[model samples]
Target: MNSRIVLGAFALTALVACKEKENKNIVEEIIEIEEVQPTTYAEISVKEGGSWKEGTREYIDGSFVNVDEMEVPEQHTDHSWYIRYEGPGWENKQTAYRLYLDWRNAIDIFGKKVDTLVLPYVGTDGFDSYHNEAPWGQDILKAGQSMGIGGYGRFTGDTIAHFNEVEKTHVKVDNSNSSSSVTIDYKGWKTGDVTTDLESVISIFPEDRFLKAELTPSVSFDGLATGIVKFDDIPLMQETSETGEWAYIATYGVQTLAGENDKLGMAIFYKTDEAKAIEGPHDHLVVFNPSTKTQTYYINSAWDQEKGGIKSEEAFKKDLQTKLSELDNNGKLE
Candidate 1:
């Protein structure tokens, strides 16, 4: 009886030791995952600590402060200087992007050199500091009079009508460990004769240079389009995925604002069925079919100066093809 009791006690002791070891292993694994997890960021900042010029469209004498949501003041327009970076900015490890948030309503890319969150630090030094090349990156695209890459507007035959006549504009931002997004609500957006409300959600994931835009218009009308900005001597490239479910409109050449020699590639991926036509006179446009339902599309860019980035047109095309295949196989790019 004494021997049996001693053996039972020894067995219990061994079992407890084994359980403790297992628990310790799990704790270590959790710590490892927490340390290496990716991060994404999004934010909108406005001038504070100063007063808005009374009866004028100006914000004077204040520093920028980050905000979660904002109602665009009635007197805002391009280079108004009230909003930092001129609008909401978002970024993942690969790249960063921002919208004009004013009459231009155009999208722009911020080429990144490091693989970390940098949007919060951007434009903090000054409004125009980002235009020049820095250690992180620079405002690489010259949008000009076009919808900077994947920015939407109403196609009115010979012209693309931007958000020039919106009654009000509201913007909100969301950020998480896995993704970051900006939601813009345009109330009473007037383009030509048609007036409708629009909600544009632009989101970026933790691993890629592509940002997804999901547009939902309150009323259905024709000629809703998104496109890449046009540049001289840079030819547009278009192709359908192997599965034929996805297609892309792209351009690659010495087009970045960084310099005449700096190469940048921009592309828009859309569902083949949702696209009504691919037309271009001002910008490389992808006109979507008329519907009240939410329409989805993606905008991507690659800068030659980025760390481990695509340097050649051939590699850019190859990377786009891989993304197409991923989209075709999984119904989404992971």
Candidate 2:
């Protein structure tokens, strides 16, 4: 009788344990991570572990894991200038920005969708025919940034010098990941005689209104300015950190798609404990006194017609405040 009782209790305990295990299994089956969705694919300039001679590339599905690729978009060229245009030249489904490798340290703007440029345009060559529809964004940022639209420049305590500021190295790109990015190599750009060794990685996404600039310098450098062309007619609106570690500058007024008399907002953003003072150089400059070798900043724009936000000065300022907060919150769900 005693042995039978002991066996019955053992059986009861086993049954309970089994039932608990079964319930746990059911809960696990209900919880699973959904896979991420794929966006537009990328096929970048030949500069990525390849030769520069190739002009365009066909889109390969997993060929690029990132949504932003270079080769997939329409690219205008001045091949009449070079054998191969190994531009850090890049365009997304919505916008275009290219490196004038032969021109200067400047990055030229090609604002519209490449498809739009397919239409007719100005002065033809010796052939007297319409050459190509010019880049609608046309270098809207004229001496705005000598390094050519965010390229590094030497602040000679006077005028900025960008000529021969970057490495002769061909532009290198990485579109392999789901997000497309381009890198321009520089040992360090010189201003007068001061040279800071650093390489810049610029990455962009399909839905992003801005691109991020990741700068790695071999040594600490200061007073680097990221700016835009200043028009006496357009008003500049911005704010600086009381602590001098962060800054935001923007111009909202007559700047627009193709520089027409429409509304556009161009801005630069940076944050670091090393920032010293923000000043208006030839155009606009956010000065930073570096405490570390790695620095990150952002440059972007919004066209009242393209992106659906902040057309008025009041709205634009509010958006900037919100963006700063979002960045501060580690990109939280707020």
Candidate 3:
């Protein structure tokens, strides 16, 4: 009788354990199915990596990614979703920023997207930490960056320079008119810390003008700076029947999680003839830094409608000279 009781108890315990195990298995199976269901059928593509803010995931076939937040909305597709990630204080302790472009519009300018359309991520302190309200007004820049509007062909150059007065890294770019030639001095660019010297020269035609822009930055990663010069056939000014040409000159700093601090400086030089030719106003200097998620842009507001009425040449030279002087004071100009 005792043996029978013991056997009965053992059997009962085994049955209970089996039932519990079966229930647990069922629960686990359900969880596994749920986990796979969300992402299983999604098809996504990254047109350009690291172009948006840090956490940006997918860029639709032909759409724009929001630069301020580095977000791409999920389109209504059967099995695909795209997302960008980043918010306040994304790039280190500093606010994160990105440049956006409509892919369709950009493709029209470049003819095709190759290795040239992208600009490296930049981090600097002097750039504006705010966001632009309108995409139409923000048309001057792209996600990466493009240079020169196509037809006339623009120039681009980049180098790593130091602001000796203060400790900073400077990347200089020069844009020349169609007729002139530009030279870049790349002897001192390095992938490590410790400052160096860099210079970029641009030539322009008598009918065209030139502008020199620089971004002085402090970066977190350890890598070499890769600068690109590309001609983008995008129309910036729609006033005339002319589809203007522009060039995107860029220099990329190493990626970093800690925030970087720096300044942006630019000088615009106008050819005597081009300066004298009255045309709509244009931006003399452009700076786009994704780490800061901001752009420092300079425009020559002093335009003369009457031919030769404005001291365009004198004013431009004076402007460039003054900025160069400031750089000198800051020990940035070489």
lDDT by residue (tens digit), candidate 3, 1-334? 1101221243455445556665466545445433322100001112334233345443334331222112223321111223211111111110111211112101001010111111112111112211221211111223223221110111122322211122221212222212212222223333334333333322222221222222222332221122222223312221110111222222222111112321111122221211111111221123222221111211111222212322344553454555434433542221
1-334 per-residue lDDT for model 2 (tens digits): 1101221243454445556665455333323211122221222222223222356432212111211223212232334222122244444444445554432555544444342321112111211122233444332344434443454454556665554544334345554324556765555456655676656677766554566777676666655655555666776677764544456777777754344565666777777564432444555665556544656777666555443444576776776766666666553211
Candidate with top TM-score is: 1
Candidate 2, residue 179: CA error in Å?
A: 1.3
Better of 1 and 3 by TM-score: 1
Better of 1 and 2 by TM-score: 1
Give the TM-score ranking, best first: 1, 2, 3
Give lDDT tens digits, candidate 1, residues 178-281: 68789999999999889999999999888879998999999999999999999889998998998799999999999988886899999999999998546667
lDDT of 2 at 47: 21
User: In each prediction, how many residue pairs overlap at the backbone (N, C-alpha, C within less than 3 A)?
Assistant: 0, 12, 19
Global lDDT scores for all candidate models? 0.85, 0.48, 0.23
In angstroms, how far off is 129's CA in candidate 3? 21
Q: Write down the TM-score of every candidate.
A: 0.88, 0.62, 0.21
Of 2 and 3, the candidate ahead on lDDT is 2
